[model samples]
Target chain A: MKIPLPARFRTPVLLMAGLTLLVALATAIGSEQLNFTLTEMLIRMIVVIGLYMFVGNSGIMSFGHIGFMGIGAYVTAWATLAPEWKQVMLQGLPAFLQEHTYPFPVAVLASGLVAAGVALILGAAIMRLNGLAASIATFAFLAIVYSVYSNWESVTGGTSSVIGIPTVVGPWTAVAFACLAVVAAYAFQVSRYGLMLRASRDDEVAAQSSSVDIVRVRLVAFVCSAFLVGMGGALYAHFLGVLTTDAFYLALSFVTLSMLVVGGIGSLTGAVAGTLAVTLIVEILRACERGFALGGAQISLPRGSQEIGLGLALALVLIFRPAGISRSREL
Target chain B: MVDPLLRVPQPTAAELAAEGVSVRFQGLAALSEVNLTLLRGEIVGLIGPNGAGKTTLINCLTGFQRPTTGRVALAREDTAGWNPARFRKAGVARTFQAGRLFRDMTVAENVEVTGVGLGLDRKSAHSVAMEVLDWLGIADKAARTAGTLDYTDERRVGIARALVLPPAFILMDEPAAGMSDSEGEDLVGLVTSIPTKFGCGVLIIEHNMRVIMNVSHRLYVLDGGRTVAQGTPAEVQANPAVISAYLGADV
Candidate 1:
């Protein structure tokens, strides 16, 4: 039987079907914990896929992308916070920003746009660098952003958690955003610019001589990925109903990066798989720590078993399959 | 065979000239006072011993390197200090010494991407990729991943990539480097067709004397970052300075 969609789309369609099934099953069970876990997985998928859109195609690892998430979370908090709360909490805000509260969707969109704009400015400076230098530059950028957000007491909550963000991003909303992210990433990946960027990533000199415009392509990928990741950040803020700089700092960056690396640093399928696998492993390890019944006996792991076990599992996966579980193969 | 009144006149091909170009790395000069010219529809071979500044000169002409003391003029426009993409947009295409095809893409994509990068629409780029691959006689390998190609096919895809740009001037750097004698002969045949069939100028940097001598209309010999000889292949062959600088020791 002839399939209706073109062959190129089959893998992504299958992937989407699988993801939808996961969401459906989670929602149907009506387990709040399962729904929350699935929601967290979806948000991480958005961020990891967003990271993949740039790092996978451009062949440059960016530690600074989490900074965009931080920016997005803060922007959402700024826009969605009650005017009276904002006036008391963020006195450094300009009168206009302190006066109005926008819709959740608008806040999300605004945060994404703001992060993309910041990416544009940062990429102009950072994309000129290549390889390890560029990676370090991104780390520096992340550090700079973290330092500013950590100390900007009036504009941001500054080291304290910003509260009352309104938990509106349920599992369904998260899945919707994740689906949008997947489509956006797939669309960009197959676009002319994406092809050009990947070409440049594979062989820079050849790409440049072929007129691929390396810097421009890199900048475009950076901005687009930042915007998507920023949206993920907004979702996270609303999901948690609070925000802190630490949530978008090294812990989030490394966890997301580990997920990306474990899944397959080169493919979208890897991103989704890595996020799900890591999240499941973390949950299982946490359960183990809290004590579990096995063979009719109570078994308990150490308190830090989640972190140690996750690290050990990642190491074993890398040792067995250096390219990650996916090995760069896409759906 | 055709009516003279119906045939349109061909526009004269533009000239690409590098005048007194020099490249210095720190205190050492890679290319000093190197001068070369390639006219549209002309095949110019640049031959040199190892480290004779042949590739450096090519880099200068193609805008990959900035000449510290000279200029690259394309159709009378000074193109010195321009990036490689700008040079490509201005119709200067080049193949790398290594066949640096995008490993993940198929053979046809290597060509198609270049065409698209050069401003061809996707539909046209696809057709152009097919046409160019067919023209290069590598049409059968179009669906194969570029990284999996055998040596000769890699070279052909590299040439096909540059040709798809349909450039005004195409530079081939060591295209025949790793080929067998028969393969070199086949490449010579294929490269000889480039200028005439594609209606573009060619600057071929080859270590294979047989290919360079057989294919280029004129040959320029470089030694120690300076042009030692330039003339018809026969004329360049008989030049004593060229012979001593490159050929005498080997030949």
Candidate 2:
């Protein structure tokens, strides 16, 4: 789903399908280290696609999406954690989450729903603002969610990590969810509401005059985008078997959004491509930081170089290809 | 495809009116105590010089502006607090002086979005979009990126977007702004046919006296935001106030 996709829509769909195939092939044939990196990269891809569904179509950047991801991770963690673990760590949880362990699929569905529910309530108020003010409000929202989760000890385990989540999700499952996000986001990209959302983004005056309810369409996208990002968070919890609110804080927001800008903020292809390119680049940078022998000489970069490298990459993309590597085109 | 969206109920004797409407921005009066009416099955011309508040009145009638001292009514109900989007959804559409097409979208998407906003499913919206684009003779340009169009075609696409709404009262603001003489003549045919062909009332804002006079079933003339004269084309042409307001601008 590139921005300004020609009406055909098949090529971008095929592109996402192709991404799934490569992930499957990698996990099946590649080494353990490669599988680990692929899983993380695919999860980031799903998160970016969720971001694209709202930011790409509505032209509203959000710093709060990772906040949804945190909510989802926590919800899924609460659902799937061993009852004994929950009873110990999250004493303030409702009776249902504290005493019962749901099936993994049920936990996953609950994560998306809870995130979407929060989005609906918040978006109703925030979507009334436009442009920069709305963006800042979303950042504030993320900060508030972060502060609450970090301090709500009994319900959220406070600042401590909640463990004992089953680590059942692998690279193949990540790929499947990534593919599902792509198809759903693509369907929205071509649907009536998507077209209207993009229209409103292009020219608000023109769109409203055409009878497009600016706030309503924006809120709908906000809720739907939150649902997807929330599901991405669930995948993270299951993959790591741990939950930490700080992991879903400012750093995660910046890193995922950077992938979007580096790939193509306006197109679905850009979202996927950005995640793939940035994740791989960060992994390579880390691998370099941990010294490797090259022709009997130790080849290594200084520690903390990944941040510098990622920052430089983001800067270059912004200055040279402001539309992202996909140039906002799907094909 | 059946084009259910384009098959609007025929000519329900609709009326959009302004009673004693006036607008003041801070201290300057843009329009004062102005009255205008448009009815279905008719073509009405609203002509005035620059800053005469032709577009301002268009805004007021279509809910873009709230009159300081009057009410705008659609059919029989007062549209006092409606927004522009509600106005469009209620079957009143207006064009801007600036042809504000969604530059990044294809022309077809630009028109189809209106159908969707007005409650059509995507499939029906597409059918209506193609139907109206065909009617406006820009069906070939339906897939073209709207931003790439020349000024004249941009205006054409703007008109096509408005027509897709199938509005009961379509208020056109300088619909022929960038056209050549021949293109202007073509616009005359399109503007005049809107009432009979699409079953809508037309309010055309134009500087070109000849074109509006040629097509309007009735004429409403304004000067300095005041009603100067209104009647049949011949009656308004013979009025001294009308001639003086023209000031030899267009005879």
Candidate 3:
């Protein structure tokens, strides 16, 4: 159906509508357990699409974005947790946060801003490096964030699940934010900044010769993508009402990046498709691992099938369709 | 009615000059005390052999290289250490010998990006790109991916993109490297019209002596990175030093 929007916005708005409808379908037909699964899917979609906004446009594989997600998740935890709980369990938070709990929207915005702020500071230095050096530097950055958060016992509760946060994120919230991420990313993809960025990606020399500031443009994309992923991380904090540093570590980074790659790392459509495709496969495998009842028998894959299956899937995609299923094509 | 794309920045008595510029590599002088200048509304040809430092000179003029000694001046203002992007923003644009088109973008996008980089809004950039493409007579190929263009078309798009920068001084590095005689004739016409049509100075490096002689109002001949001759096209063509230094080896 034709959406009465500007020509520049029509496709993204339509894509958002389609995703919302799919989530609505899932909500209507499924039980509460299914709602949780759908929420997970939507949240991952937001994070992966955020990755694409930077990686796809700049052709830079960032290993540090999930660090921004962790910051967002932790910020939301600090902001939304009851003041009484913070006094007893944590005292490192500033007085304002320690004294008052904020609404969901306020915490989400704070999460995104704080994450983006950190990205701006770090990306200034990181974006100066290129190719393999940039990749390794980002990886090193991710490790540093993980270590700091894991050991900061006073503020972070360190290496353990920080609980007592309000559980406000549901399937609907997840769906709404996923749609927002999709639209925002699309708007950015066609913006002049995005155009200059993709130009640099194709040929750094050509883009510079055209008067593009390559480092500055990459940093802009970095900060913008961090904002989206940070909010996605905040949703995750409320989804389960617990924050664990492990959940925001290397495993999360690789899984989200794999979704981007397997779906087509070059296009936003690939980000969405990769996340959905990989999430469904893992969920199905998890169900089998739990032993599904078959004809007069219980049949199941062995334990730890999900991780193994993900590896094989990524390997197969790289071997046959290295560009991913969408092949970087936009909607 | 004049097209908006044609209404570029005023000529402003602009002059892009390399004064006593010298570049040395590991104690070897690549360019020794070379000086050249391009003024608004004039076309000058720079002719040299393979290692005559023509591309290196273009790099110095356009901010890709720093001369070991001496400074480049734009409009009589010294450009001490400007980078390539800064030089481009100051209305000096150049194209590579290799035709470095952004392979992933469409032909129109290749030009539009330069316009946008030059601070035009997206809508204006697109219109300017369309106008430039139309003027180049390749408007039909606007939607084709740059990587998919044939060799000749890549060169055309390269020139089109440089023009979209609205440059006050343009340095082309072997723009007519590979083309038929008829195609070369068309290029000669295009080079000739650039100064009058866009109010920009042109410094073209082409090995085709016939084409360069036909298009240039004046010529600067470089052999072994030093000026062999500099004068009106006729004056330079008849100089024994230029014929012996350049045409002797080339033809």
CA error at residue A295 for candidate 3, angstroms:
5.5
Q: For model 2, how does the per-residue alpha-carbon lDDT over B62-98 read when each residue is reduced to its tens digit?
A: 8889999988988878998899998888888888879
Best by DockQ: 2
**What is each predicted model's overall lDDT from 0 to 1?**
0.87, 0.88, 0.88
Pairs with backbone N, CA or C atoms under 3 Å apart (clashes), candidate 1: none
Per-residue lDDT tens digits for candidate 1, residues A1-331, read 1225667786577678888889999889999989888898899899999999999889899898899999998999999999999988899998777999899989999999999999999999989987789899999989988999999999998998899988999988998888888888888887888888889888999998888888888999999999999999999999999888888888889889989988988888888889988998989888889998889999999898887877887898889987788888776
TM-score of 2: 0.94
Model 1 CAPRI rating: medium
TM-score for chain B considered on its own, for each of the candidates: 0.92, 0.93, 0.93
Per-residue CA lDDT of candidate 3, range B154-205, in tens?
9888888888846888899988788787886786687788887788999999
**Candidate 2 lDDT by residue in tens digits, A1-331:** 1235454667566776788788878867879888888888888888899999999999998989999999999999999998988888899999988899999889988999999999999999999998678899989989999999999999899999999899988888888899889988888888888999999999998898899999999999999999999999999999989888889997888789999999998889899889989998898899999989989999999998888899999999999999999998786
Candidate 1 residue-wise lDDT, B64-177, digit = tens:
889989888998888756899888777888898888999988788888787778766555666778898999898988888899998889999988888874788999899988
Model 2 RMSD, rounded to 1 decimal: 2.9
What residue pairs are clashing in model 2? A1-A268, A3-A267
Please report how far candidate 1 places residue A49 from its true position, in Å.
Answer: 0.9
The residue pairs in collision within model 3 are none
Worst 10 residues of 1 chain A by lDDT: A1-10
* Model 2 global lDDT (CA atoms, 0 to 1): 0.88
Q: What's the lDDT for residue B235 in model 1?
A: 99
